[model samples]
Target: MMICEINSHSLPVRPRPVQGEATIGFLMRVALANGYETPRQLWIGLRTFDAVCKALCLSAEEENTLFGPFPSYWGHNDFKYGLTAADFNHSLMRWCPLCLRESAHLRGQWMLKLCCVCSRHSIRLLDRCPICGSTQRLERANFDRCICGAWFANAQYVDTDVESVVRITQTLEASIFDKVALPSLPSLSAQEWLRLISYLGQFSETFQPAKPGKIANTHQLDTAMSLMFNIGWLLDSWPENFHVILETIQRKEAAKLSIRRTFGSMYRVLYVDLAEGCFQFLRDEFERYLHEYWRGVVSKRNKAFKPETVATHPRVTLKQAAQKTGVAPAIVSHIMQSELIPYGLVDLPSGRKVRSIHKSNLAQIKALMNGCMAIGEAATLLALPECRVRELISSGIITPLISRVHDKSAAWLIAKQQVQRLFFTSSEPRNVFSAITVRRLLKYWHLRDGEFMALVQALSESRLVPVALQSTPVSLGNVTLDEQEARKWLEEVRFQVGSSMSVDEAAKRLCLKQQVVYDLVRRGLLVTIEDKLPGRRVMRTSLEDFQATYISLAEFSRSLQRAPRWVLKKLHVPPISGPLIDGSRQYFFRRSDVCSEALRVD
Candidate 1:
C-alpha cells in the first residue's frame, strides 16, 4: 500500500530490514547490496544521511514486511550520541567474527556500545582487522574480505579474562531495554551510561598527556573496549572494588599515595571532560569514596574535590576546625607543631603545608583545652601575679598551652583548667602569711628580674604562703605574701651587697655620673652612713628619698633626649634646686614638674 517515495539519486536496491536491526545496521547492509565502499559513500550517493534515514523509515510494504509499522524516531537515540549518522557505523564497528560469518548483518545486541563479547557466541568483538592491522569497514557486497584483501571472519577471537567485562556489558545493556538502574551501582539513566562509557574508560590507567590513541589492530581495539567494559565491573561492586583499584594503581606508580596521583586523569575527565550535570552522580560517588577511603591531604592545589556540604566533615579546613571547636588557629597549630596533636600536610602551590588533623585528633584538640585564656587571666585564675606566673613558666614550673616565648601571636594561651589545679601555698592562712600581696613587695622593694624569678620558684616549691586571692585582678596586682618574711628576704639580699657605696656604686644607683654624685654628696643633698670598708657609703634610704621627689638635670636631659643646657634655656622650666638655692653644682627639678613641663604630660 504505502511506499518510501525516493529522490532522483536514490539507493538502487533495498533489502527488508532484519527484525530488531539497528537502523545504521540496515544502512550498512544496503551499502553492501549497492556495491558502495562504505555506508558513508552510500549515504553520499543518496544525497544526505537524513535523506537515507527517511527512505528506510518509510520503505515499501514488501521491504517492510520483516517488521511491522515503524516510528519516525526509532533509532534516533543511538544515532545522536557524539556521532553523526554517517560516521556512527564506521567509527564503532564492533562485531563478532563468527557471528558475521553466520549472518552478514550487525546484530541489535552489538548496537549496545558496552557489549564487548557477543551474547550468542561468547567471544570478544573485533573492531580492527587481524591480518593487515587496518580498521575493518563494511566492504562492498562482501562480508568475508577486509579492505586489505584478508578474510575478516577467519580471524579467531582470542580468549582472556573478560568475564567481568562481559558481565558488566550485559548489565549495562540490560539497563537499556529494562528501563531500570542496577541497585548496586550508581543510579544513572540509560542515555547517561551510553554516553559515559568511553569517557570514563580512559581513566583506568595513569593519564598520559598524549593524544587519543589509535586502535591499529584487533588486539588494540579489544584492549580499548575492555576499558569501557571494566568501568561497569568496577562500579557494580561499589566502594570495596573502587578502593582496591585505587590501591592497585598506587602500587604500580611506586610513588607516594596521594589522591592526586592515585586518580590521575579521573579528576580532569570529570571537571573538564564532561558537563557537571551529565556525570554528577559519578563525581559525587567518587568524591565520597575519596573522603571515606583515601587518607591523603586535600586542598585547592591538588585536583581532589573540596566539597563540604555539612559542617561535620572528618577532615576540615584549618579555619573550619577552629570555628567548630572554639579554638584559635594558632593554638591548634602549636598543638600540632609540638606533636601533641597528630596532623598531615596537604599540597599547596606555595609549597606551604597546611596542618590537617584527623577528626579524632581534632576533637582531642578541643578536649585537651579546658579553655584558653590570656596570661593575665591565667594569673588571676591561679591567684598569682602575672609576673609570678611568667616566672613560673620561665622556670618550667607551669606548662602553657601556647608558649609565650615561642609564638609571635603576642597572646600567651594558658589553660585555665591547668592553672586552677595549681597550689600557690598552704590552704590555711597562718601569721607567717601576711595580708600584703607580693605585688606590693615588687613595687616597694624594686625586685630584679632574676630575684623575682627566684621568689616565684620559692613559692612554687612551697617555701612561702599566698594569704589572699584576687577576686578580680587589676592586671594581677594582688597575690598575698608575708610582710615580715618579704622584709627579711630583702634585708638579706641587701646585706649580701655590703652596706656601702663607692662613687661608682652611688652614680649607678642614682643613674648619674660619678662627678655628679660626688658633688651632690659634698653639698649634703645626699647623706652617707658609716662603713667599716674604705669606700664612701650611702644608706639604702638615702637613694630612695633622693629619687622619690627630685630628678637631677642629667637624668632629665637623658629622659628628654636633650642636653642639660637645652632643657634649661629652651624648655623655660627652671629647676626647684640648684647652685643658687641648694648651694649645689647639680640642678634638680621636682619629678612632677619635669613630667608635666618637659614631657607635656598632664
Candidate 2:
C-alpha cells in the first residue's frame, strides 16, 4: 500500500526584502546618476525613500529630512551632493547606448546636421553638406567634446569628454522626437505604446539642452532625461493616433516655446514629481497584458506505434500538454504550425497532436530544445517532477528548475514534458506562462498534477521500480528505546528522500564515540519523517554515493584516446604535485592526489 501524506505543515514564508533607509539613499544616488530625472521617477524615489525610512524605524523628522516634500534633501538643491560621477558611470554601463557599445554610431560615421563647405550654414539633409562640412569632405572625426570642445585623445578612439557626449545624447533625443511621437498611435498596441512611453521618458532624462552658466555632465545625462519628461513640453501631443497625438503635442510645445522660456528642464522635473506618486503607480497603470486569446485545437497524438500496442498509453490533453511541457499552446501550435501527423492518432482538442520521439532520439531532441544534456534524464529517467525542470526550462529569466526540484528534503518528479522541454536545446518556447494565466489559476483553480502519471504508478506499470539492494534507513526495524535514546535517535535522522533504514535503527547501528550519526542527519544524508514502530517519526539514510567524492584522473587520462597533455589540460589538473627534476625538464605527481583533485572538480 502507498500513502500520499500531507503534513498539514504551513511552511514559514520569508518576506520579500523591503528597501531600508540606507538602500533608499543608495537608490536616490543611483537614480540621480542614472537619468531618473522625470517627475515620475522623483515620485518613485520619494515613495521608496519613505518606505525605507519606515522600515528602518526612523523618527518622523528624520523621515521628513530624507523623503518629505519641499524642504527634504530629495527636493532641495543639495541632493546632487549625495550623487557622484561613479554612480553615473555605473548607470551608463547598464543602459546607455554609447557606454555599452550598443549604438549604431560605433559601426560607421553618423551624420549629424548637414554642413556647408564654407562652415557658415548647416542643414538637416543627409547627402548635402552644412557650411564647410561637405558630405564628400566630411572627415568622420569622433566628437571629442560637447559643443564646448573638450576632447579625448586615446589610441582606442574612445571619447570621454562631456561635449561630444552631449552631442550623442542630442542625437538620440532627436531620434526619439523625430521617429517616435507622444501617446503614439492606435496602430500600436497598448503595451507597445506603454513601453515606448517609458523608453521616451528614459531617453529624455539622458539628453537635455544645456543651460547658460551650467556645464553639461555626461554623468548627469540620466538626470537630464528624467527632467525632460517631467516638464511635459517634451511631449507635443497625446493623440489617439499617429496624426492626432503628434499634432497636438507639437502645437502645444510650439505655444509653450513662444511663451516665457523660463521652463528649465529641472523645474519641469520638479513639477512632474509633485504630480505623479512614483514607480508603482506607473508600473500598475502601464503594465501590458502580452498574452493573446489562444484557441485550443483538437489534434491526434503523434504515436506512430500500433494503436492496440500503445492503446492504454494514457493520453495527455492539450491543456495538460501545455502544462506538462511548460510550453504555451500557441508555441506548440507554432511547432506543429502546419506540420501534419498521421491521421487517427490521439491528439488534444485544440488541434495539438500527441507526439512521441523514440526514447533514443529524445536526447537529440532535448539538445535542440534546451542546452543541458542530462537534465531531461534527471526528470524522465529519474522520475522527478515537471516543476523541478521548469526553472531549467525557463533558464535564468525566471526561477531555475533547480529551485523547484529542491524540496528542502528530496528531489521529486513533476512532469515529463517539463523534463524533455527543458533539456531539448535546439528550440525554446517563449512567453509560456502569461500573467493572466497564472493569475487566473492562482485566483480560482486548484493546482492539479501536470504529469501523465505518478512516480509509483509509472514504475509499477513498467515493472522497473527499484528494489531494496542494501540496508537503508527506511528498511531498518525499530527497537525498544528509552526517552533519551529516542531523542538521540531522532537527532540522528533528517528528512532525505530516497534514503533507507529507520532513523532509530540507523542511530543504533552506528555506535560511535561522538555524534557521527547525528552529523549525517544535519548534513542531509538521512530523512526522519516516516512513521516508525510505536508511532515515532523516524526515517532513513540514503546509500552513500562515491561519485559525490571520487574520480580517478590518472585512470581517466589513460581512457582518453587523445594526447596525454590534451587530456590533462581538459581535466584541468596540475601536471605535477612533487618536486621538479633538474632544469624543470620533468616532474612527479601523486596519482592518488590527482584523482582526489579530479573528484573535487567533478
Candidate 3:
C-alpha cells in the first residue's frame, strides 16, 4: 500500500505501478475498456472517508456520526456511493471497494455486534421489521465476532457505510497508483498463469463502460470495475494491452456522448432559445427551497404557538388528514371506528371527504400492535380498503397491519396499491353531468307547453330525447342575474351637489343612489319606506335631465353676464341670522318663469 502525506497526516492511496509487456498482455486478455476507467481523482473524497474511518477504527459514535452505524447506507442503492469486497461477488452486497475496506476496519474495531433478533435491528431505510415484528431491533455481526459468540470467518464483514468506505478505497488506490510504483512481476508458472487467464476472462465478460452510457447498467459496470481493480492489485505492474481496450471502450463512450449532446441540445432549444429558461430554472429551484423552508417554519410555529380558546373544528376525512398527523391512512381509519378511546369523529366538507378523530385513538392501535406489525394484517385492522393499504407498503403507510379482527365495523383494510394509485392519479379528470345547463334550458322554456314542445322537437330531430353529450350545452357554473340581485347591485350611485355628493347608505346597501335611487324610493323602488334610514327622502329626477338643466349659481351668473334670477331675488329678500336661528338666502323660480323673464340668450 502507498501512503500520501496530506495536512501532516499519512494516508493510504491507490497503487499504480509502471507499465510492462506481461501486464499489458493481461489487460489485453481482459479487454479492459477505456471509458470504464473514471479518473481516481474524481472519487478522492469518498475514498478518503472510508480510509479515515475504517471498521477497525470506527466507534459507535463514529459509526453513528460518520459512517452508517447500521449495516446499510441510508440514501442510496445497495452498491452506490462506495463498494466493498463482498460487493464484487454478490449483486446484493452493495458495498464499493473503498467502502468495503473501511467497513472491514470498522467491524474489526466494534469486534462484536448484537444479533438481528437480540439487537432489535432492521435495515436502515426499512419500516417493516424483518424478523419478529413485535421486536423492532436487529443488529449486524461485527467483523471479528458474531452475535452467537463465534469469531467471524476471515474477519470478513460487509460495511454499509458507503461514502466513508468509498473515500478510503480511493485514498488507498491513489496512494498506491500515484506514489508507490511496484516493479513488474516475472513470468508466472503455468498453473498460476492459467488461473490469472481465467480471472481475466471473467473480468472482460463483466467489464462495463461508464459515463454517457446507460445509467440503469451502472451497477453492472461498478461490479466489473471492482473485479478489475482486485486483479490489478494482484499483478505487480500496469497492464500493457491498454491501447486496444481503451479504443473499444472509447467507441461506446462516444455513442453515449452523442446521445447526451442531442438531448441536451433539444432541451436547450425548447426551453432556453426563445425565453429566459435558465433564469426560470434557477427561480424554480429557489422557490422550491423557499417553500420547503417556510413549511418547516410553519410547522415549528404551529407547534410553539398556543391559543387561549381551542376551536372545536369539524374533523376532515382520513384521506385529507393523513399528511397533517403523520399517521397512515389505515391507522386513521382504524381510529375513526375506535370505541376504546371513547372518541367520536365529525366529517367536515372541504370539497372532499375529510374527517378528524382524537389522537388518543391512534395510541390505542399502537398499544395493541405492540409498536409494529406485519404488512398485510396492519391494513386489515386499520379498516382501510385493500387497495389503499397496499399503496403504503414501501414506507409502511400504515404502521401495524392488523392480523386478527373480532369486529367487522371496527376494523378496516386499505390496500397499499389503492392509496398509491389515488395519490399518483390525483391529476386526472372525472366525468360529471352539468346541472347548470339543464337549469338554463328549463328557464328558456319557461314551462310553456309550446316552447317545451319546440325543444322536444329539436331534440327529436337530432335523433334523441336527451341531447347527445357532444351536442349538450356546456355548463358555465353560473346564470344571468335575477331582477332583485341586479337592482341591489345597481344601488351604489353617488350624486354631486355643490362641493359634496349625496348618497343613501340604505340605498347603497340596496346598490343605488341619487335621483334614480330617490325615484325608486318615491315610486316605492324598495319594498318598504320604513326600511329606509330616517331623515332620508327620495326624489324624481332622471340623471340626464338633471345634468342638462342644473348649473352652479356662480356658473349661471357668469354665463348670463348678470346674476341668475334666483340669486338676484335671493339678494332682494334678506334672511334673518342669529345664534339660535341659522342665516340663509332664499330664492325660487319655475323653469317657465326663468324662460320668460331672462332678457339675454347665450
Candidate 4:
C-alpha cells in the first residue's frame, strides 16, 4: 500500500544529495523515503546528520549542494541578493505543483520572494493548498499529497499572464542561480539591479501605505511582490524614460532651490554613492535638465540659493530685491511698473502678486539686512529661539558678514523656508518605514555617525514622507523628519507582529528538534511572531499527508498527454470524487486495495 506509516518503524533510505537540492529539502526527502513524518524524528542531533553524511562518504561538491554554497549562512539564506530575513519567502512553503510531481525535489531559488512564477510550467506558485484552504507546512510525509489528502500536482493554479512578472523573475533567476548579468537590463551588477528596482518601487508607489516597522508576512510578501510591478517596463526602456522618474520625485520636493536638499536620499543614491557608476547617465541627465530649464527664485537675502544657481535661475521677488539693496519695496515695485528695470510681476501660488527682478538689475538692489536687525527680528527670520541663535553664534555657526556680535542688540540672520513651506502628509503611500515629520527630523532626531543631509533629502523626496499635516502655519520646530535611507529600510522596520509562544511548545507542534526549532526561529526559516507578551510564537500547521490513496485525472493527463476528461472517460473506472458529485474540480481514482476493491484497465 502507498499509505505512509508514521510510527516507530525505521526503514532508512538515506539518498545522495542532488546537485541543486536545498538542505531542508534533502532532509524532507530522506525522512519521507524512510516512512518518517519529519526529518527531526529520524535523527537525535545535527551531529547525527553529519555522522550519516560521513558514513555515506559524500564528496565536497555534494556537501556544498546540500548545504548551499555557504553552509554557515545557509540557515538564513543571506547568500541570495543581499536581502534581509524578512524579504524572503522562508516563513512558508511556496511550491510549483507540477515541478514537484515531475522531479519531487525542492529548488533553492523558490525561497526567494520574487520567485512567484514557475517558468517551466508558466503558472503562479501555490502557497495555500486548494483542498485544505491552509498554507502548506514543510513537515509533510509526501510532496505530492497535501495533509488534507489532496494531490498537489492536480491543484489548479493561476497562470502568470503578466509578461513583466515572468521576465523579471527569469532575469532574477539567471542572475542569482547562474551568477551572471541580467540578460538585457541596463549594465548593472545583479545586486545593483535589485537595489535600483527596490528604490524605484519605494519611490513610485507611495500611495499604498504599508504597516511600517512590521516588516514581511504572507500579506506583506504579496505587497512586496506588487513593488516589482513597473520595474521591468522601466528597465526595458533604460535612461530614455528615466526623466519620468525624476519628474515624479521633483513633484514631492517642497524645497526648490538646491537639488541636494530637495531630492534628498534619492540624490545621495544616484550621485554621492560612488559604487553606483552604472547610474552615471541618470545623474548627468538630471543636472542637464535642471541647468537649462529650472526657474528657482534666487536672492542675496535668501542665501539658500548658491552662487551658481544665481547665474542659472536669477529671478527674484521685489521684496527680496528690496531686502538685498536696502531699497524700499515700493521703489522696486515702481521701477518694475515704469519698465526702468527688466522685470515682470509674477503671481505666486498663495495668490500674492510680486514683481520679479532681472539678473543685470540685481546690483541696484544689493544691500545687507543681517547686522542691523534686532535679536527678535533675527530670531523670527531664522525660525529659532533667541537662546538658540545666541548658542549658534557661540558655536561659530552664525557667520557675521555685517553684524558686530559685541553689540548686544545686533543679530546675524539667514532666510528660512518659513510657514509657506510647511509640510503636509498625503494619502499617497510612501514607504514601508514609519513616517517622521520634517519638524521632528530637523530638531529632535539624533544620528550618531550618520549624515544629517541624507535625512533631509529623504524628507524632501518623500521617502520618509509626511505623516502629520499642520492645519495652521507651524514653526520649523514642529515640522518633523526621522531618519530614512536605502539602508534604513532594512534597519528600522522591527515592530512585533502577531503573538508569541515558547520554543519547546513550537518545536513539538512543528515536529522539529528543539535545537532545530531554535535555529529556524533565529534565522527566520520559519514564520516567527513576536508579541509584547513573552517568547516568539511558531504557527506550525499539522502534517498529516499519509499517502497517495487516490489519483487525480489531471495527473494522469500529464503523463498520457491527453485531455483530463478524456483520460478519465477512457479509464473506465468510477471516481471517488468529481465535479458532479462533490463539487471538487479533480476526479479521483481509488488505488485498489488501499482505497477500495481492485479494478483492471482495458
Clashes of each: 0, 86, 96, 18
Instruction: List the lowest-lDDT window of 10 residues for candidate 2.
Output: 114-123
* TM-scores, all models, native as reference: 0.47, 0.17, 0.16, 0.44
Model 3 agreement with the true structure over 10-60: per-residue lDDT tens digits:
323322211211111111111112111221321232333344234124444
C-alpha RMSD for every candidate: 19.6, 32.8, 29.3, 38.5
Would you list the rank order by TM-score, best first?
A: 1, 4, 2, 3
Alpha-carbon deviation at 419 in model 2, angstroms: 5.4
Compose the digit string of candidate 1's lDDT tens values, residues 1-602.
22343464465675766655655566667667766655555544455545665555545543332211112232233333233222123334567788778876766556444556765666777777788867654434354577677776788786645566666566555554454455555555455665566566544434433332222331345554766555655665765666665565555543332565555655556666665575676667766765664444455555335446222346765676788889888777777665666666555556666556667776788777866788888777655667778877877656677874888656787765556545443345455534566667776766754777666556666665566433322222455767877665655455454445556676876767788788877767778876775667787678777888788787778887788777777655677668877666778878877777865521
Misplaced by over 4 Å in model 2 are: 1-161, 165-416, 419-602
| Candidate with the larger lDDT of 3 and 4 | 4
In candidate 1 the C-alpha lDDT for residue 323 amounts to 83
**Candidate 4 per-residue lDDT over residues 400-519, each given as its tens digit:** 323354323243433222212323444333343555544344355433223334443444576654433444433433444334543343233211222234567555544446865565
Candidates' lDDT values, in order?
0.60, 0.30, 0.30, 0.53
| True lDDT of residue 549, candidate 4 | 43
The TM-score of candidate 2 is 0.17
TM-score winner between candidates 3 and 4: 4
